[model samples]
Target: MTKPTLYLHIGAGKSGSSSIQAALARCAVPLREQGFLVPGDKLEPDATVSGHQLWFFQGLPKDEPESQKKVLRRLLRCKNAMAEQECHSLVVSAENLINRRKFPDLFLDVDKHFRVVVIAYLRRQDQYIQAHWQQWGFKSHPDFDDWIANGLGDIANWDVALADWEAAAFKKQIIVRTFERPKLHGNDVVLDFFNILGLDGKTFDLGNTEQNRGFSELTLRIAERNRDLFDGPHDNRFFAFLGEHLGSVVYEKEGGSIHLGKEDRQRLLDRFRAGNERLRKTYFPDQETLFDESNLPDRLELSEAEWSQREHDLIWRLLFAMHRRK
Candidate 1:
């Protein structure tokens, strides 16, 4: 027997990857009872439960190519170990496996284990670009506009991402989840994926949506403290510690909207309009036949003040009390 295996949960930029991973980690025991080992190698029922890959970038020396490669090697070893163990299922989650200047060792390592199907839930491009910017800003990556400015030339092209995935033998399972549909209503988005795997319906109870209702005060605090990239890696202890604390406030931030200016927003929307069309033609030929992008929010931006609130700490405490740390 080939042994039941799957290499999935690849994501498009920032569509609830953290939330999904965190939820799965939270539901580890119950899900395992149904026969799915979220992170097969952990040997525990938990998914490679904590930490985000982008956090590692906070530890890299900006100008050092050798240093970049070294950290990636470390990332790959950890991901590979998680994938190789014998189990009914396994999942690896990371956003940069697509965009960055290059991929981490996890890409190659994932290839060796199972037939990989890339699960990328795409929102319209305009929203994606804006959300990416909000993230950079929240993480203290210079002025928010600066990151968007640099995203022009190659960044406008999402197809390049498809090409990169092709190199790793990954097939795209791009589910264009619209903003209107589930609005990520609750566990629907997650349960949909679970059903794709043919798992039983023991459904997950999603926690409060308020705590993650934007980046939160905690994230803003860290970004403020670690604003300089060049000065970052030297503060590994700071980043690691702050990161754990920040993790608490990372639930989905509901309301608030970012204003990326009409011109800039339209320009990005146009790019995604064109780019998404190309994605349909070049990759997912029959987009209409595949998935709909119409309802997916055109732009899911996090307004500036959304991250400025101090009330987040109190909310974080409450969230931890209800959910507790894993």
Candidate 2:
């Protein structure tokens, strides 16, 4: 039988992307038996984020297609692996990939020879904007406002970035998820997601958040201090030399209280409401009202001293693990 194929997921970043990626990586063996082919045992490089490898600057000249083509060349190599393996379906799960203006153009290239579908998750805009800001802040961003003015600050209109997925005519080809529901735990979400790809889950590991879940204020500050540190490949070495120091620098306690404020938050929330309405009109109903903010963990609870101890302990443990691996 000719191996049928589908690109099962086109992600919305920070919406449990790490967990989903972790689940697929852990269950590679079982997933293969079911005819799905995920990438091999390696973390794929992210070209778009702070490290600057993807070269997705908004105002780059059209004559400078060379920059984007470099990224596409790498993607083609990955696509070749999927086709050669003759796996049932493939999921291209990078949130930033869909954030580009050329999403439809890019998908057309894939659908020329393969079936393609997009899977995405949504969080309320107000909450997500704040979370997204805090995430960027975790990188030790000194001038946080500048980062917001340029980068994900406009993410409330992220669908606008992708030419709005609905405008791409992916009605039957896309999956949109809201993060409000609790059952969407990393593995459980994928188990439910599998039905869309004609997949089924089996005995597998839990979510990958165990090691990197909590973000203390202290840890977030450390991350922001040397923001541009851990990034990109170094001569085919997947565990680049710089990333080796992530434990030394980052920790669950580094993140302090978020300060996006009530006024700024309200503005962002209003934008999200507009976008959410647009999304529901095109896709599902307005079932997004279910997310209640009262249940979220308090962000300002951790003191500096408490977080510093946690940071030191986690880093010490990580250094020991790395030493043992050597």
Candidate 3:
């Protein structure tokens, strides 16, 4: 029997991961026919982005003994399924896998089943922060300034993260792809991933939808102020409706760009410059720069008081929307 191949899409985060996971789940049956097995539907249905999340969650350090026992069973089940399918390759994708320091140890549990390959996509540092902040700001008070001061280092420092993953014992070849659309193969991440795997597009049902669109700063600020209202269990349905409606309402006004103060932008660029350069030289010798920085914009042209007024107005509108839902 041919040794199976295991491909792990370890995301650099905020780089279209939801879309990729959805694509894999959507095309599972067709993929299996082509000898690629993406197992996880038993833990989560293919309709959701967390379809392959069990593999990632199981890999993390767990405090509960019962849960740890389940992890081994899960791995054994996956191996058996692969054997039954006669699959030559298996793929498990999750953004959390990219930055997890204990990544190598996590895969040691299943390394005997297959040869491992790590695939990742890196986004521009500035864009990565804005995208991440907007997502978290919707659920909590992801203070932008605080993130810049404390969280930026890990998120922006691709070199360190990549280096650690490369050093991991389970890692075979690490395929690094830039998240920029123009730079991506066929201008689509899903297609580009298929290219990396050398899979025939006609062999799989390659359908996809855009997922996790970024919220505007104004929308995020409003969401942050009212985070308590949506944080509880009662708010899940309400937020689901809000997420759908808000996209259309904000679509026209959204510039699709996160504004940062010129000084702050320069600070971010300078901070990541050496690290990004080293990353490119180490992994992408042909590329001069890891990311494009020419079009970064200055902060939104609004004073604090004016921005606060807008927040108040947005809160009122949000309350009205909730009332209308009732």
lDDT of each: 0.49, 0.52, 0.68
List, in order, the clash count of every candidate structure: 10, 17, 0
Better of 1 and 3 by lDDT: 3
Q: Write the per-residue lDDT of candidate 3 for residues 1-326, one digit (tens) a residue.
A: 56678787888667878778787878888787787777773432222333366354645456545444455566566667777877777777877767656554555555566677888899987777777666553354456677678655576578878778777664347888889889877788777888788875545666654665655667655556666667642244444566655545543344444346767777887888988898788778998788877777766676789878877776676778767777
Model 3 CA deviation exceeding 4 Å by range: 41-50, 54-59, 63-73, 137-142, 151-153, 170-172, 232-239, 251-253, 256-259, 303-326
Tens digits of lDDT, candidate 2, 48-127: 22211112333334543553554355445555665576565655556565566664544444454466677777666656
TM-score of 2: 0.65
Model 1's TM-score against the true structure: 0.59
CA RMSD of each candidate after superposition: 7.9, 6.9, 4.1
lDDT of 1 by residue, 1-326 (tens): 35345445545555656565666666656655565555422222333554234444434555556655564455344445444543455545555545554553234554443555566555556565555544544343555566666634555355666566665555453333432234433445555455556653345564531212235334444455556632531333433444455554443344333445556556666655655666666555644622343433333354547544544654566567556656
Q: Each candidate's TM vs. the true structure?
A: 0.59, 0.65, 0.81
Q: Evaluate model 3: give its lDDT.
A: 0.68
- TM for candidate 3 is 0.81
Report the number of backbone clashes for model 2.
Answer: 17
